[model samples]
Target chain A: MKDALAHTHARIQPYVHNTPVLTSHLLDELAGATLYFKCENFQRMGAFKMRGAVNAIMQLSVEEQQSGVVTHSSGNFAQALALAARSLGVAAYIVMPSNAPRVKKEAVLAYGGQVVECAPTLTAREQAAQQIVEERGATFIHPSNDLNVILGQGTAATELLAVQPALDYIFTPVGGGGLVAGTILAAQYFGRNCRVVAGEPATMNDAYRSWQSGTIEGNDAGDTIADGLKTQLGDINFPIIQQGIDAIILVSEDEIVAAMRLIWERMKIVVEASSAVALAALLKEKTRYAGKRIGIILSGGNVDLSKLPF
Target chain B: MKDALAHTHARIQPYVHNTPVLTSHLLDELAGATLYFKCENFQRMGAFKMRGAVNAIMQLSVEEQQSGVVTHSSGNFAQALALAARSLGVAAYIVMPSNAPRVKKEAVLAYGGQVVECAPTLTAREQAAQQIVEERGATFIHPSNDLNVILGQGTAATELLAVQPALDYIFTPVGGGGLVAGTILAAQYFGRNCRVVAGEPATMNDAYRSWQSGTIEGNDAGDTIADGLKTQLGDINFPIIQQGIDAIILVSEDEIVAAMRLIWERMKIVVEASSAVALAALLKEKTRYAGKRIGIILSGGNVDLSKLPF
Candidate 1:
């Protein structure tokens, strides 16, 4: 796992930013912990999802590359895959929900992805992507379920751990489990005393429930402002998450917004509500993590300025 | 001038952020120049003013340090002085206009500065600061006119030039002329071919008119969305400005707001309208700077989010 991660880091080094690690005296005082934020929000395509997308596309064979790649996503991953494919000189087919924001669709197109909109449902998205794969003979790359993508996502944690080896905890927001699983793998491979922790919105606490019940659980209604963490854990990444993550912290919608505002106002950095969940989780469990050195993955900075919650 | 700037850089090295240089492919495509942003908005107290404040306070003798320091600013410099003084374990007296934003006043207090509110006029602010100086024997540190403050402000450009010495131009928003004058000195000393340019709001184009007429000019009514760049150049900094600045570009209020939005949305960084003026000026003169490497000073990020123009 360590060797694979190191290889991924080397492969993606040229294509992505190493992204700076930022600290705040005010944030440290608030959380009562020494915090190191890995600013992947400043990543290419403005998200850590770019890391996985690039990795997945890079692993394709010459023939597979010629055939191109496809993915079904309406979020950062959609833009990530498009940008990664564009950088790697491959065709990309994006299957986005019809109800997705026009801004997001335009962003995917701007990144050179051929967008194929479908009914705003999982089944419809999968069907559209399947049709693309069948017609073009392109390989379908799952956003987070693929082994290569998970290995790629782990590189962020690897870089963080490489710099701050003595971190007591590493926090990441749980979505399709790609980031948390990758973080776990990196911590397992490189960390000295670091334990991987997952932060989930209480409104969509599937990951938290899944850990407690020892089974995968989906949210009854994905109604959180943390739009990134709405998806449930997948079979490919769930077992890794279950084994690697020390705990899953759940935070309210208000907590998520408050944390987001704090980062924007105090740190003067634009981070999405999903990215704020990691810091929110740490703030929620301030007593446990007080005075400890911790790392947080700021997942992305892609947010619509018109609809700012603050 | 170079020796003084070097000394100021070393003196304030432990007190302020060296700040990151950020670039955007989209922004580069929009402006013909390759724009490198020296992000002083990310500096301590969220402004480049911190550098000047720290340097000015550090230059004081033990007897003067015991007497403390005072400044009259209703903007970023007030917070900068307060924070710098607190960091150095010295008392700070801030004279703020009575109409200053509650948030700005709170920030000054939070930084351990004693805020004295007076009428909303330059004369009133100076009178209040004078009162503090007379009563407490505090040394008045002019926001941008003092030689020490100007030397301190030059350190940002020094750092930027040290890293990218071959830059063709450096853009800064001009108000009281400290930043532009300091940048000119740094470029003269450190840069190979870099020239310093000033950006000012058309509503308050004192710097631009002053440069054209070979004399200091003051705005009749300081009215601009970029509240920071409304002040006129002073005696101490005006001569330096005349000697050092290559050009001063004037931008409209609408242009300033549009540029500010572009930076907020694309760069995912919270920068005040004053910071945006530098980019607006570059964009306005895109043809001249085509394919050139240019550096822009993002003056500050301390803004009232509730009153955001975007």
Candidate 2:
């Protein structure tokens, strides 16, 4: 896995930026820790999802590449896959939810990808994507279940620790467990004293419960503003997280909103709701992070600004 | 002055972030050039002004430091100076224009500075600041006129070219001419290949005319949404700018607003109106930058979000 991450890093070096890390005295005081924010929001596709997508796309054989790649996403993954495929000169078919933001759709189109929209349900989207894969003879790329994807996602943390070597802990928001699992693996392999912790919204705390019970817990039918975190944990990602993670903490919606507003107002950085969940946990004084050099992976920055008020 | 910039960079290395220079393919395509955006919005105090404030404050002798510092500004410089002074355990007095944004005034107060609001006229603000400095026997730190401030401001460009070594041209919005002159020195001293250019709104073209002729031109009344750039070029900055600056491009007020919207929508980065002046120059397709590796210093990120619709 470490070798795969190293290979991905080298391959994607020319294509993607090593997005900047930012620190704030106000944010540090609020979080009760000296926080280092790894701003993946500034990534090429405006999210860390590109790391996984690039890894998967680059590893494909000539025949597989010619056949094209496809994936279903609420937003970020679709844009990442589309942009990555475009950079590699491969055809991409992105299945997105009909309710996805217009900006996300525009980004995928701007990258020259064919978009297929389905009903908002995950099962409906998957079924639609599967049909497209069969009809077009395209490869269906799972967002998190693939080993290459997980290995590639791990590189963010690896690169972070390389630059900011003094980190004592890492906090990342868990959606489908891909980022958290990859981050944990990277921290375990690269950082000697760093602890890997996952943050999730209480409204969508399946990953938190799954980690606690040693079983895959089903999400209830409640909705969360963190749209990226609504998905179920992948099989490949779950075991890696189970092995490498220190703990998972859940935050309230209000906390998420407060943290999001704080970053926007004070740090002057636009971060989506899921990324805010990690900050929310820390701001709410989640134990194990006090008086330490804590690194937070700001997962994405694809927010509908019209939806947020100052 | 160049030697002072080198010293300032070394002294403030631990306090400030060497912000990244980001390349935008979309922006580059629009401008018909390769654009390197030196993102000082990510700098401490959410602007490049901190570099100057930190440098100016740090260079003060023990006796002078005890008496503290005074500055007059209605924008980023005030907040930056106040914050830098607070961090150094020194007092700061700021005299702001009566019409200054409430948010900016609040920020200075948040940093534990004494703020005195006077008439909106430049003369009135200076008079108020001078009175305070005289009464308290405080060192008056001119935001853009002082040698130390210029040296500190130059560090942005120095750090910029360190990461992105191949720029052929650089564009920065001109206000009091401090940023342009400082960047000019940095580019000349470090990366001699790069031609430093300044961008100013047609409404505030004193620096443009100053670069054209051998003397600084005063504006009777400069009107623009870029309040920070509406000020006349400083005496110390004018001579340096006249020598090193290749050209000064004029952008319209409407163009400035358009550039501001584009930055917010495409980059997902919040920038104040002053920063938009540089982008406006590029979007207008100015001849000097066509097909060139152009570096643009995004001056600040202190927008009043409540007034903006997304």
What TM-score does chain B alone reach in each candidate, compared with the true chain B? 0.98, 0.94
lDDT, candidate 2, at B149: 87
In model 1 chain A, the worst 10-residue window by lDDT is: A213-222
Q: What is the lDDT of residue A50 in candidate 2?
A: 92
**Number of the top DockQ candidate:** 1
Q: What is the per-residue lDDT of model 1 for residues B1-310, given as tens digits with 9 covering 90 to 100?
A: 7788898899899999999999999999999778899999899999999999999999999889898899999888899999999999999999998898888899999999999999998889889999999999999999999888999899999999888889999999999888988888899999997899888999898988888898888797769999998788999999999988888899999999999999987888899999999999999988988999999999999887667776
Per-residue error at A149 for model 1, in Å?
1.1
Runs off by more than 4 Å, candidate 1: none
Among these predictions, the greatest TM-score belongs to 1
Please provide, for model 1 over A1-310, each residue's C-alpha lDDT reduced to its tens digit, 9 standing for 90 to 100: 7889999999988888898899999999999989999998899989999999999989999899999999999999999999999999999999999899999999999999999989998999989999989999999999898889999899999999989999999999998999999999999889996899889999888999999988999887669999998888989999999888899999999999999999988899999999999999999999998899999999999998778787
In model 2, what is the error at residue B121, expressed in angstroms? 5.2
- Computed on alpha carbons, the lDDT of every model, listed in order, comes to 0.92, 0.84
Candidate 1 docks at the CAPRI level of medium
Q: Interface-residue RMSD per candidate?
A: 1.0, 1.9
DockQ of each: 0.71, 0.44
